[model samples]
Target: MLSLTRRIREEILVIDRQTGEQIVIAPTAYRGNQVKIGIEASDRFKILRRELQGRERGPGPG
Candidate 1:
């Protein structure tokens, strides 16, 4: 994965539409377009780690 370059800070919150529960996530640029999908802490960490690892390893085998 290529570097994002820009350092954008934003918060992600998961809320139960029916139950009215709220979960606030750390500020990360990777939250783009998926903020409404209800991302958990573990999921966020996995995504961030994978993203960083991919950037370091470059593209996958074709």
Candidate 2:
């Protein structure tokens, strides 16, 4: 995983070398210990938080 420190309104660009896919991440707001980010990506991509992904998949193989 890549870690970065960005201030509000700051933007970062990520590119997938093989597929030439691009994603933009920008920090929108900060409140207390939480932060709001904006992500720009193509519709072909699927993005989800870890918890949400788990819920979507339900329980793992028993």
- In the range 1-62, model 2's lDDT, one tens digit per residue, is 88999998789988999998999999999999899999999998888886787565557798
Model 1 residue 3 CA deviation (Å) reads 15
C-alpha-based local distance difference test score of model 2: 0.89
lDDT (Cα, 0-100) at 13 in candidate 1: 61
* Model 2 stretches with alpha carbons more than 4 Å out: 57-62
The per-prediction tally of clashing pairs is 0, 0
Question: Local distance difference test, per candidate?
Answer: 0.49, 0.89
**What C-alpha RMSD separates each model from the true structure?**
11.6, 5.2
How would you encode candidate 1's per-residue C-alpha lDDT over 1-62 as one tens digit per residue? 33333333444565769966666554343454542323455332444544476566668899
Error of 2 at 26 (Å): 1.1
- Which candidate comes out best when scored by lDDT? 2
